[model samples]
Target: MGDLLGVAVLGAGHMGADHIRRLGHVVSGARVAAVADPDVERAKEAVAGLSGVSVHTDPSAALDAPGVAAVLVASPGPAHEEALLACFARGLPVLCEKPMVPDSAGALRVVEAEARLGRRLAQIGFMRRYDAGYRRLKALLDGGSLGRPLILHCTHRNVSSPGHFTSAMLINSSVSHEIDAARWLLGQELTAVRVLRPRSSSGAPEGLVDPQFVLFETERGALVDVEVFVNCGFGYQVRCEAVGEAGSARIGDEHTMVVTTGGRAAQEVAQDYLVRFADAYDREVQAWVDATRRGRVTGPGVWDGYAASVVAEAGVRSLETGHRVAVDLAPRPDAG
Candidate 1:
């Protein structure tokens, strides 16, 4: 126990609880020292079988718990800014799940705060960058064998949305992954966004938009288009294809099994993101733990989080107005 990194996990909802399990079981060299959630029972339930773990209703209390050397923030989007600032202030390395903050202004505040500290202590959760397929595709693009990337076609789908989901969430929440993925894959910032709604799906909740088509313009003259459907009613799917001058490559078609015995081809589709990206999440957390124990922080930083917020904000505006919205970003802080 003394050799393992002590992690304080904030939020014990779906994502946080799963991460606690990951830290204890899946990921090596890390132990869950503390857990915090507004619902104390949920937090206690998440750590029910764990030993030497303290559960708290307050995140700060969890952070201050004995043996807590780092933090993993799986908290809600609105609570991210404060949690991240708290980590920065305490000089603890943290891995914060995305949106970083819900709004652009708050996201930028996180970036500025980290910049003032003169060192990076927070890693934004953009786990796609750790996926095996996305990593291969990133390597292929970086190798330059395919020439300059011209376009990216992406698809993001979910079985259904939660009851509290709103129409704006279609852009900021659903498409935020693509917003970050495109920027990382292209090595350029998103310059603009355009959104289109093609009638609400009957499967969706009342007055909520289900499927949306989003177009993102990159600063390096590449275009990324996304078809996001949160109420697809079929399965959770995320696919990306990069087209360059000489060739192209695709990924995210994780077929579980094939049944060709009946004279037709069929494969399984994942119904939840937890099942689809489980390995990626494992790799992401393991990497963070490894780096944090070595006195470093890596992966997506506050600038990437802030950039995604700005682009997502633009996408929301475009969704409302049915027009192309230009992305306006503030000056990038030195991400040291």
Candidate 2:
């Protein structure tokens, strides 16, 4: 490995573009060596001011580009499996964005493939695990200070939904973060899921379900629930409160600067996730780069990604059928 990690980033979309900037400027010991997007122009734009960076429309071509020592799969969920398998074939470390693969079956394939290799290479992008607040919560639970968490109340809200957003996406894409967080925080696998749909918001697009209530049952008998509202017409907010036998703790209060004016005081709200979780994202990538440089893998592994997919699939089924759905996961392989 060189002194600096050379990464080939796939997909120059919103998340991909931000990651490009992060690898270039924010994170140390790494550089953007290559970038790939179906739109060649976008790929070029993502790497515009970077020296010696290559841009390609084909993802595999970028992976094979010179100086590409590692890979960052920031493409849409559907494209993750192929990119991941390619990285495995090349024996390169990778940081793949969430959902790993959107379907449980495909996600399982990725898991099994890595297990077959008998080592870990892919780290799923569950940046919440790296967040300061979430990390402290995890520490509290792990240290037994929480005294057996009983329930977790989570809320996820976005100012608006993208045009291509769908009802199922509310569970799979939006709440998937919560799905993984609940698992990581509690250190338990979700056993069942149920989703309840409330009336659509008037501000929401026609034929879209803006707000959803998802319930999850853990293997250890803890309960987790998330209220997801993608078209709240306000700001992005993610909050979690874990209730345990001893006490309860909450995070994501957004205790930013408060202004007192006109006989009122109000705190600032972040309009997007990039602003809200900026430090978390930076820490996540830095950790990945540091671990990869040391010839090791850390953070959420392929199994966690697969489990999130299985639970999310169950959540989507619950959403569609309006009934509780059981989650069934494949046995863990010994190697990965």
Candidate 3:
């Protein structure tokens, strides 16, 4: 316990609880020092087995809890801005889940806030960068083995969305991962976006955009396309294929488990993001903990988070207007 990095986790819902589990059981060198959620019982339940842990209904209290050396923000998107500001004011190193803030303007505020501090304290949770397959893909792209990459074919699907999922979420929430991945993989900024909505799947909720095809134009003249279908009703899958001038590489198929029986063969697909990206999340949190203990911040920083918000906002606009929308981003702060 004395050697462990004590982390205060904000929000005890799905992502938060999973992180707490990792900190307590899976990840080494970290301890759940405190947890906060609007539902006090949920927070308590998340840390039930941990020793010397505090649970609170208000995130501020958890931030102020004794022995807290850092923070992890897994709160709802709408609550992220305030939680992040609090972390910055306290100088707590943070690993915040994506969207950073749901709005581009709010995300920029975060970027600027960290800039004002003259150092990075928050690491936005774009976990794909830590995934084994993604790391390899990044290396392949960086090694120049694939030559000058020209197009990225990406797919994001889900069994189904929650009842409260919105059409805008298809771009902002589901495709935001791809937005960051494309930027990281291509090592360039996305300049514009266009979205095409197809006929809704019968399985999708009424008025919800189930399957949307998105096209992005990168600054370096590369193109990226995403087929985001949140109501596939089959499995949750994320795949990417990068085509360069000389060759192409693909990933996200490593999760398959094959079974052969009754004169048939089948491949099992993950039904949840948690199941599919489990190892990535573990590595992401572990990296954050390792860096925080060394008195530094690492991984995707505030700028990347802000860029994703800007691009996603542009995608949402394209979805609405049925026209290509340019990503108009504010100047990056000097801290970047």
Q: Which predicted model would earn the best TM-score?
A: 3
Model 3, 1-336: lDDT tens per residue? 888998999999999999999999999889999999999888888998889999999899999999998999999999999999999999999999998999989999999899999999999999999999999999999999999999999999999999999999999999999999999999999999999989999999999988999999999999999999999999999999999999999998883789999999999999999999999999999888988999989999999999999999999999999999999889988996
TM-score of every candidate relative to the true structure? 0.98, 0.98, 0.99
Q: Rank the candidates by TM-score, best first.
A: 3, 2, 1
- Candidate 2 runs further than 4 Å off: none
Q: Write the per-residue lDDT of candidate 2 for residues 32-116, one digit (tens) a residue.
A: 9999999998888888889889899899999999999999999999999999999999999999999899999999999999999
lDDT of 1 at 89: 89
Q: For residues 58-147, write the lDDT of model 1, one tens digit per residue.
A: 999999999999999999999999999999989999999998999999999999999999998999999999999999999999999879
Q: List the residue pairs that clash in candidate 3.
A: none
State model 1's lDDT.
0.93
Model 3 / residue 99 / CA error / Å: 1.0
Clashes of 2: 0
Candidates' RMSD to native: 1.1, 1.2, 0.8
Query: What lDDT does each candidate get?
Result: 0.93, 0.94, 0.94
